[model samples]
Target: MPILQPIGRTLLIFFAAAGRLSMFAANGLSHCVRPPLYFRLIARQMIDIGYYSLPVVGLTAIFTGMVLALQSYTGFARFAAESAIPNVVVISITRELGPVLAGLMVAGRVGAAMAAEIGTMRVTEQIDALDTLATNPFKYLVAPRLIAGITTLPILVFIADIIGVFGGYVVSIYKLGFNPTTYLKNTVDFVQTEDVVSGLVKAAVFGFLITLMGCYHGYNSKGGAQGVGAATTNAVVSASILILCCNYFITEMFFAR
Candidate 1:
């Protein structure tokens, strides 16, 4: 009975945490659709999440495509199948690497920032002050971030896809000595609409999850500065984990038999 008690307690804790997170997400999402939406706040968040995030996402995407092309060439050359590099690069970039890498990068940067900002508010009584002033904190803070995250991430992912494919094209033509025209043709012919659409869908889900984790952790934070720091760390880790997990399920849903 004593040993069973510990196991039971752990299970209870896990379920409780999950329940709290779900409720927080539901509450925040509900506010997103309700009246008194803040367009200015949404625009600010969009700039923060999208515009500011471009550099990291772009660098990560371009380098990923370049490395992918180089590695594919190295492997395919062994079988005299170097011609397939363009197809591989395009399909891989549009279908997987672009969305996943961009999501992870944004989760690290934007997610941590959200957590820190909101968590600081939580610790400093600013949220309570908002309540006194007749402002709904969730509606003002969480919804804008959520709306911006969902809307902006897809655009970033699409741009990343283009940049990634172009990186591959550069490597294939300039470094591998492949014919530029032939590489471009293969890339264009091999990629389908389904691949790009699936990637965009994943981006939306990843964005929502990233913001949810950040806001949830921040809103629930306690203690003080230490707690805000912990929330920031948890936000990044949780958002990253959710991105990878959701990516697999999304891919399975789109491509599985």
Candidate 2:
């Protein structure tokens, strides 16, 4: 009977999870369709998640671009192709590394924070309290975060692209002795609008994934501290995994054979 109970409980939890996710998706769609939008909350979240996160994202992008340039210069120099460094750096940053790294960083910072806050609210029944006060938790709690993520991530990614390109520029010019003008010219000529657009699109998708996973896990947390901790961990893990998987699909959409 004890063993049977465990299995039954597991099945019940799985079904609950599926139902919760479906409901969340439906509610999100409904809120988006309805009027009386919550712009203030969304703005606040944008400041918190997007603006505050800029320093870390910018720093990461700069260092990544610098390292990529350095490494590529070494390898390409071996083939007597050092002139390709600018093009390589630009393409790599704009297409792949910028969006992916920014998404990963936000997953660690914003995703975990969202999950913990919402999970704690759940455990304390504050979400229920909102309902009791005739407030919609979906509108009040979830909408802001989702909208902020969607709006602000692209901006952040844009900044990251600039910083990353400059990082590569510094590495190429100073360390590798490439002419700055030539390097900049090669980068400008090699990159396309499509490359930048593709990365921004990926950033938006990643933002949505990060917020969705955080809200889903946190809103459904159970028990007490242990459950909240689990939700936070799950939020980060799921957001990171989804970001990577979605990157492939988005890349295919942009550049598939």
Which predicted model would earn the best TM-score? 1
Q: Per-residue lDDT of 113-191 in model 2, one digit per residue for the tens?
A: 9999999999999999999999889888887788888778889999999999999999888988999889999999999
Give the Cα error of residue 11 in candidate 2, in Å.
10
TM-score of each: 0.98, 0.93
lDDT of 1 by residue, 1-257 (tens): 79899899999999999999988888999999998999999999999999999999999999999999999999999999999999999899988999999999999999999999999999999999999999999998899999999999999999999999999988998999999899989998999999999999999998999999889999989999999999999999999998998899999999999
* Candidate 2: stretches off by over 4 Å: 1-19
Model 1 CA deviation exceeding 4 Å by range: none
- For candidate 1, give the lDDT of residue 120: 96
Considering summed lDDT, which 10 consecutive residues are worst modelled in model 2?
28-37
Residue 38 lDDT in candidate 1: 98
Maximum-lDDT candidate: 1
Instruction: Please give the clash total of every predicted structure, in order.
Output: 0, 0
